[model samples]
Target: MEFPSRDLELATRQATLESDTPQIVGPQVVLGQGGFADDDAPENALVAVRDQSQWYVADSLHQARELAGKVQGRRSSLEPRPPLELPEGDWALTLRTCWVEPAYLETDASWCNPQDEPADPVANGGAFGGKIASDVTDVARELAQANDRVVRVLWSREDTVRHGPKRPPVSVGLRADGSGIFRLARTDHIDERIRPLLPKCEIEQVTIPGPPTSSAIRGAGWAEVEMLRAGLSGQAGWVTAPSGASAKATIANELISVEVRAGSPLDWVMFRSYCIGAAHMAYSWVTSEGLSVDQNGDVHDLTIRSFGVLRSSDTPEI
Candidate 1:
C-alpha cells in the first residue's frame, strides 16, 4: 500500500469557522488532572526556592515561602519618572514606562533526578513566552545532583514577576506621511525584528535599567508600532502573522469586533475562546496593566494583585 503525501494528509484535516470541536486538553485542564511539571514530581522531591541571590531547598512550599520572606527585597520609592523625549512630529507618543506582566497562572517550574536531565519547565500550561530563558531547569538539575536526590524548583509569583522577560517599552513620533522615530528598550537584535514592521520609521534601541526585555514575547515591538500607526491614521487594519494567520480588530462603544482567518483552525470553539481571551488581555493591558520600575531598576509591582489585571465584570463584551 502506498502512503499518502504530506500535503494530502494535512488537507484532510481542514477546519472551518463553524467547526465546534473542543480543545484537546480542555477536560483534563478544567478537571485539574493535566500533568503539570510539578504534579508528577517525586514524592520526596526537595523544593527549591530562591532567597534574594541564593537558592534554598525546603521541606515544603510553606517553608520555602517562609525562607523567601527572610530576605525581603527593597521597595520602590514611586518617584515621578523622568519623561522620555521624542522628536517633534504630528503624532508623538512618549511611553517611557510601559510594561506587561505575563501573569500566567502557572509559574516557572522544573524537576530533575540525579540520574537524568531536568524535566521541561513548561510541561503543561503556558508561560506566554516568559519562560523561554528560565534558569529553573538548570538549577533543578544542579540541586538534584548536589543533594543526591530528586529536586523540584519553582518560582513564586513575585519571583516570576521580577525575573520573567517583559515587552520592551516604546517612545515614538510619527509624521503625517508615516515616517518617524521609533525608540525601544534595548535587546539583542530587536531592531532587526522591528525594522521590517516600521520600515518608514527610524528604529533606535536605548538602554534602560530594569527587567530584561525579550523580542520573543507576543508582538513585543511590532504590535506597538502597528497600534501607533492605527492611532495616527484613525483606522485599524489587518494584522498578518508569519504563519499566514491574519486578523483585524476594532473596539468601539464598549464592544470589540474582530475578523480572523487562520487556516485549519481544527476547533472553532477553542479558537474563538482564545481570540476572546486575547481581546480581554489586550483591553486589560491598555486600560489597567503596567509595572512600576524605580530608578534603581527594581520592579515595584511585584504582587499579582498590583498588576491591575481586569476583573471579569470590568472586561468589555467581545
Candidate 2:
C-alpha cells in the first residue's frame, strides 16, 4: 500500500503451490481442532509492548487465526458479550473487514438494517489484507435484530479457516528461455500485478474449482508474480504497487535483500513493520508455505504448526 501523503508502506509475501494440486482453499497449515485454532497452536502477539503491559485479543480457544491480529497495553479485561445464538450454517464471509468484538454498540436506531448503520471493528487498516471482505458486522446486525439484543460474532479459528477466504493459488509454467505464461483462477490477470516489475508475461485463466479465494492478502499477487518471473529468468526483480510503493527483491544466494521506498513515510513504525513483515512472508511463501489436499478437496494439515513457515532458527538473515 502507498500514499500520496508522506507515508511509505511496503510488504512481502510468498507461498508454495504444487503444480498438480487442485486450486482449492482448505485448512492446510492451520489444522483446526475443537474451537478455533488447534489446542497446540503457538501463541503470537499482534500488540507486544516491552513494558509487559498485556492485552490479549484472540486466544488459543478463540483464535479465528485468519487475520485478526493486534493487542494493546494494560486495561481491565473487558470480555466482549457473546454473539446471539444463530443456528448452523448461518454465518457469512467478506461482507467487510469485521471483527467478532464491536468496539462501540450504542446505536440510537433500533433493529436497523445494514444501510442504517455501519461498523468498522478494525481501527487501522484491514488485517494483513486478509480481511478484505470479512462479514462479522453483518452477522452481528442480523443476530441483534432477530434476538433483540447486542450480539457479538466471534468466528473460531476453525470457522475462519474453514469458512474464510484465502489468497488464491496460482499455477505457472516457465520455459528455459525466460518466457512463459502463468495460469490463475477465474478472472485473475497476473499481468496487472507483474507488468510494472516484469515487462512481458502471458496470463492464462483456468476454472479450478476450489474454496473462497482472494488476491488481496498482504503482498497480494506481487510476490508470487515475481517468484514466478525470477524462477524463469534466474534474476532479481522489483515489486510494485498500484499506489506507487516499490521494492527491489533479489532472488540469489538463497538469501534475500529488499529495498523499499514510499513517497514519504507518515508513520515509520507502522510502514516499516508491515514492510518487514511482508518481506518475511513473501520470502517464506517463495521458499515454503503450501498445503496438502485430497481428491475431495479437504485440507490435511489444519494447524499452522504444520505450515512450511520457516522458524527463526531456519532463516539466515534479512
Candidate 3:
C-alpha cells in the first residue's frame, strides 16, 4: 500500500487549480476490508510492530494483561513479515469535494456484500482517518470465510497509537516575523500537502525512515500549515473538506474563532462537536504536541504520559 510522492504532486497541482477544495492527498496504498468477530472467539490484534516490521495481527494492549498467566511473561522474538500483495492502481486519479458535507455514498447499496460495509464513507463520516477500522472488517471477513466463524478484530489505545497512521511530522522554518521559509517532510506528499494551503510558502523534502505517516488524521498536516500561515499572514487560515465543505478561522492570543459553511450541518450537535474536536486537535497539534524518534527510527516515548501533551488548562474554550 503506497501513495507515492509523484501522485501527490499531481493531486496538488489539480487541487491548486481549484481553490475551493481541501488539500487532501493520500497514500498510494489504500487498505481495502468486512465485520465484528464473535465475542467468545479469539481476539485478533491489529497493529504494526515497528521493530519486527509486522502489521495487524498482534494482541491488543488491553488484552495483554490477560495473557500474564497464560504466557507467564514469555515473549517472542521479532520476525519481519513480508508486505501484503495488492493489485496496482492508477495513482493519477484525482478528486475534489468541498462545501459538500452532509454528503456520503459508498458500498454496493445491497446488504448481500458485507465486505463492502467499511467502504461506506457517507454513513460513517469516516471519522477523518480514524475510520481505518474498515481494515478490521476485511480481516474479520477473511477469517470467517476460511473458518466459517466470527473473528473479531480489535486493538487498544496503545496498539492504535503504535500501529496507526499519524499526522506527518514536519520541519518548518519561519522568520522573526512568522513568515514561513520552508516546510519539509519525507512522510508527506509535499506537492499538494502544504503548498496548496500556503501558496506563498515554500516546502522541501527531507528523507527520513520511519513508520507510515499521513494527512488522513482529522485535519492532519494541512491544518498545522494553514494555522502557521494564518499567523504569518496575519489573517484567518482557510480550510476545505473533501466534501467541498469549508471553514475559516483566526487565532489571536491563543484563542480561536471559526465560521463554517457546509451544506447546512445535518445534526447541530454532531456538527458542532466534530468541529470543536477537530479545532482542539488542530490547536494542540500546532501548538504543543510532537513525536520524537530515535536513530533506529524507534519512538522512545510510547506511553501517554511521555507524549507531553497540553494540559486541559492549556486548552482554551472555543
- Index of the highest-lDDT prediction: 1
Worst 10 residues of 2 by lDDT: 93-102
**Top-TM-score structure, candidate number:** 1
lDDT per residue for candidate 2 within 1-318, as digits (tens), equals: 453433222211111111111121233323533122112212331111111122222223234222344232122223211111212222221011111111111111112233334244332234454444566555546654554444334443333444455555555444554345545554344457755654544555555444455565555556666565556555765656665677886646766677886665445444566556666766665555554433344444444444456665676566
The C-alpha RMSD in Å for every predicted model, in order, reads 6.3, 16.9, 14.9
At residue 237, candidate 1 shows an lDDT of 91
- List TM-score per model, in order: 0.85, 0.56, 0.55
Name the runs in model 2 displaced over 4 angstroms: 1-118, 175-179, 187-191, 194-202, 251-256
**Cα lDDT for residue 188, model 1?**
72
Q: Give the residue spans of candidate 1 off by over 4 A.
A: 1-24, 70-84, 87-97
lDDT for model 3: 0.43
Worst 10 residues of 1 by lDDT: 15-24
Cα displacement (angstroms), candidate 1, residue 158, comes to 0.6
Ranked by TM-score from best down, the candidates are 1, 2, 3
lDDT of each: 0.72, 0.42, 0.43
**Candidate 1 vs candidate 3: which has greater lDDT?**
1
